[model samples]
Target: MQRGLSRSSSLPATSELGDALRACRGAFLGVGLMSCMINLLYLTGSFFMLEVYDRVLPSRSVPTLIGLIILAGGLYIAQGVLDLLRGRILVRIGTSLDEAMSARVFQTVVRLPLQSGGRGEGVLPLRDLDNIRSFLSGAGPSALFDLPWLPLYLAICFAFHAMLGLTALVGAVLLVLLTVLTEFMTRSPARQASGLAAQRSELAIASRRNAEVVVAMGMAGRLTRRWAGANASYLAGNQRTSDVAGGLGAVAKVMRMMLQSAVLGVGAYLVIHQEATAGIIIAGSILSARALAPVDLAIANWKGFVAARQSWHRLNGLLRAMPAPTSPMQLQNPSQKLAVENLSVAPPGEPRVTVSEISFVLQAGQGLGIIGPSGSGKSSLLRALVGVWRPVRGHVRLDAAALDQWSSDDLGRHIGYLPQDVELFAGSIAQNICRFDPEAKSDGVIAAARQAGVHELIVTMRDGYDTEIGEHGGVLSAGQAQRIALARALYGDPFLIVLDEPNSNLDTEGDEALTRAVRVARARGAIVIVVAHRPIGIEGVDMLLVLKDGRMQAFGPKETVLAQVLQRPAAAPIKIVSDGGVSKP
Candidate 1:
């Protein structure tokens, strides 16, 4: 009963594989029909030979025999052509499925919430992608195509002799058992191997990122040692999986030989007893071996299936984990007005909210400067307003509508957000800025770059905005990359702009230019919110909000908050008015 319950609980093992096959079910059906036709032809030819041996040969009807041979040749040629067409169609189907599954996996990875710590760097992503690819490419469809062949082969075996048919049936059952056992035994190690592979991929990425630093510090030897250690661990894990799989395969080999010998021996005894003819027994033996062929192929490729299954689950889990938009509430058209009410922002795996019960608002044409010490939740507050972190206890709004009511795509279109880390892709600069918006013309892109103070730099490039920038804008300076990223945000002319420490990497001239851009945006009736740890050029603007110890310590105009915090004695720590319950003086 426990075993039955366990089997029931396992994700309908057929679903993922079935879905993949059904994606190209037409080609699969064609292959099946052709296989059946081939088998029928073979059976007819076999019976023809049997009749010739029993009657035609004794009668010496050479003309009839020759005609039968010619007919058999024609059938054989027709079967070959059909088989070839089926194989070509099947290959096309497999290729299409591979491309589709790979695309799905890639899309899923990109949509997953960013992971922090060491978890994000390792082999998890690659393993998932490779698993999905391998499944669709071969392991999945191979098993699917075998399903129709199994019963068909069984029927053919049964028609030859009852005893041989019974023996073949038993052999098939044992072969399936062996394959399942092999799959079960190798599954755990394959998971470990996949995990190790993920880790290796992450390490390689990290090592590349730190390559320049290592070389500058003359620590190449040390870095190499660390990399070697990681590789060694990955190799060891892979070998363990291979060892288990190889061991199980050896055992299955022995079992298959024993089972086949037993079937042949039984068939021989039946022939001696005249229970079946020589041709019948011969055909039965061949059919029994053929029946086991699919099982053997399945067993040999079980590792790929296990890997793919793990990947499929990984992708499913990713989609499951994304937060749904707030239910039933509707924000059909978002506006520029941004408000955060009694908001609490918490990072992943954190017990305490970083910013608690904080409330602020940014009206159109209003620019607010958020200033605090490091780790004061200034950036956290910005993230919350942008819907990156949905508040635990309170609501966020845009134009009096709940922020959660808006879908991610709609939210992005309405609000322009630039995180501290400026990431660029390996593509032409214009492509990176416009992203999926193909209608963004060259003039629009150049104008955006000019507004972000990056036009001069872009024009200097050999191909202007068409020039390719390597991964993460490796060819550009920190300030240049930040400016280009800002241009990307500005390309859409979003009504609400949220900038987190935008001036940190800029020189004095660049900082002033960015300040001018913000002023220009404000002039255009856009709301701008800037989160900065230090004094910024945007300091003398409108309102200020200070957060500390997860509570709003002060909220008012910039002068009011700064003056109140500065009134404390020279040696004493600055103290601003807190919400009373959540913080201490």
Candidate 2:
């Protein structure tokens, strides 16, 4: 609810995600141990095959066969349990990481736009966190962990026969190369796909927000084609990644199968030459296949690995660039004055200052109105005052303390802001007025509603104060939404109430209510600033400022400033209307 923004100090340093990851080293080590046990146990099947052929069959002992079956079953069961435990542990690791970082990630999401103007990435940081968590929890990590055991499997195959060992070693090398190939092929396309997806998401959000405009103007077809173009670009990049991964995965699988067959053939030739026992044939094949399995799985998951890596890099950059805020010492609400000193302003995300070298001071119980031609920086100044846009230079102080000295929550409590565009969240009418405060009082909601002149209108609705205002208050008329927004600005009788074009959408009665609201706010010893589009909107203010082409042209008592600008006598009343015309005396 704090409407003000100031980058008055360096952002606090942050490396929390990295620290959280490093903290998980111990848990990852535990998973490594489980993997070790699981991989060693994988040899159970190969050795059992060896025993069946060379020991049990050769001796023709039924007891030995029964004993071998019992032993292999127990080992297999143990391996399965360890695997299950490892999977559970991995899942918990992902969840733990999410729990540690999601809040901070969301904080960055909210602050990033304010700091960077806007990169149009839109919630991508949250999506990046999700992508990383998914990669960790999925089969990718297991494949990576088991990849180191390939040499162990190869060594066992070597003990069976030299030819079998060579075949397995060659297969391992080939599979590793395929894995590398997959990495190289997919990285660039994955990056492209990610960007295109973000662009597509931005387009969808804009379309939804301006649905009325699009539908009203017969822009539906044009918008659809635009969306389709973006979708096609994203699809192209994503499809390229999938094709490369799938192709490489298929090749890896075929290579592993062929290697197993080749090892078996070598084993047969050795036995025919009396260089090896018949048992080594099947045993070597099984071991050789297991040796390369991890590499194959790695290749299959390379796409996710690349995507997660890119997402990881993006998050790190964003986090470091816009670190979490360090809350300042809490301060009491300003009840005395609002002071502006040498204030210079610009729109967020733009570099050039739109309003320059302006200074003003208003004691409590004073109301000031700013009048200007379009593009003269009236709105820009309003944005800076409410902390929506930080000033390039100078400071806005309340109670002689600079705005940035107040923490967002503390500042929000004392400040009320109504932008030219009235944005109301989906909720009951009372909730919107109260800014969704959890402990909002029923009486306070009504008080604000009445102050904005929307109270009588509210009682006529089906649910009165409880009436649902649907999405973005779509259920209300433009004037109704604007009035409700004013009620919101007046909620809790904020110490500094700022209204930008408050009467732009209001009828005559709504305008009277707004003028009264300004009067009441001043009566309560509050400082009120109104940016008026017409002279009538400034009627409640005793002082006025005129802006022209981003410069402060005049500032003084309301009638005096008006008369000076109009070249009329001080006693002559000059009224500036919305359409660049003044009323004659």
TM-score of each: 0.83, 0.92
Residue-pair clashes per candidate, as listed? 3, 5
Clash pairs, candidate 1, are: 122-198, 123-198, 123-199
Residue-wise lDDT of candidate 1 within 31-145, one digit each (tens)? 7777677655655555566556655677789888888788878898887787667667656765665565555555445544433312342435545655555554554445445
Best by TM-score: 2
Lowest lDDT block of 10, candidate 1: 1-10
lDDT tens digits by residue: candidate 2, 1-585: 000000111222335666766677778889999999999999999999999999999899999999999999999999999999999888888888889999999988887777777764779999998988898898988998898899999898888877889989998988888887887788788889999999999999999999999999999899999999999999999999999999999999999999999999999999999999989999999999888888988888888877777777788778777767779999887899988899999766788889998877888999999988899999889888877678999999999999888878788889999999889999999999999999999999999998898889999999998999899998999999999999999999889999999999988998899899999999999889999888779889887888877877777677777777778565754433322334332
Rate residue 283 of model 1 by lDDT.
Answer: 60
Please report, in order, the local distance difference test score of every candidate based on alpha carbons.
0.69, 0.86
Displacement of residue 58 (Cα, Å) in model 2 is 1.8
How far is each candidate from the true structure, as Cα RMSD in Å? 4.7, 6.2
Which regions of candidate 1 are displaced past 4 Å? Answer: 1-9, 12-35, 38-71, 74-107, 114-130, 147-163, 166-170, 217-223, 247-276, 323-336, 534-536, 570-585
Q: Give candidate 1's TM-score.
A: 0.83
